[model samples]
Target: MEADKYVVVMNSEEQYSLWPADRAVPAGWAVQTEPNNKEDCLDYINRHWTDMTPASLRKG
Candidate 1:
């Protein structure tokens, strides 16, 4: 059996999330990476998402 594929998605607030590759991306979210295994997608998020705070709340 093949493992499920996922994609890294980002919202307007800069929050990262994983979404199934076979499903339609929800409103207000866009794909950030190509379809890949769940684990890889998660790793990408961990490496890239250094800040947990939403973009609106962060003070520059």
Candidate 2:
């Protein structure tokens, strides 16, 4: 069996999530990376999203 493809998506609050490459992205979210295998997509998120706090809650 082949592995499923996924893409990294981000919302206005700076939250990142994985979405199926074959499906449409949900509202209020934008694609952040190209379609790739699930593992790679996860790695990308791990490397990039260091902070868990939302943009609105982060202090300057």
Q: What TM-score, over all chains together, does every model reach?
A: 0.90, 0.89
Query: Candidate 2, residues 1-60: lDDT per residue as tens digits?
Result: 543899999998889999999889999999999999999999999998899999889964
Kindly provide the TM-score of model 2 when superposed on the true structure, using C-alpha atoms: 0.89
Clashes of 2: 0
Clashing pairs in 1: none
- For candidate 1, the 10 contiguous residues with the lowest summed lDDT are 1-10
Error of 1 at 55 (Å): 0.2
The superposed Cα distance between candidate 1 and the true structure at residue 44, in angstroms, equals 0.3
RMSD of each: 2.2, 2.2
Tens-place lDDT per residue, model 1, 1-60, is: 444999999998899999999989999999999999999999999998999999889865
Predicted structure with the largest TM-score when compared to the true one: 1
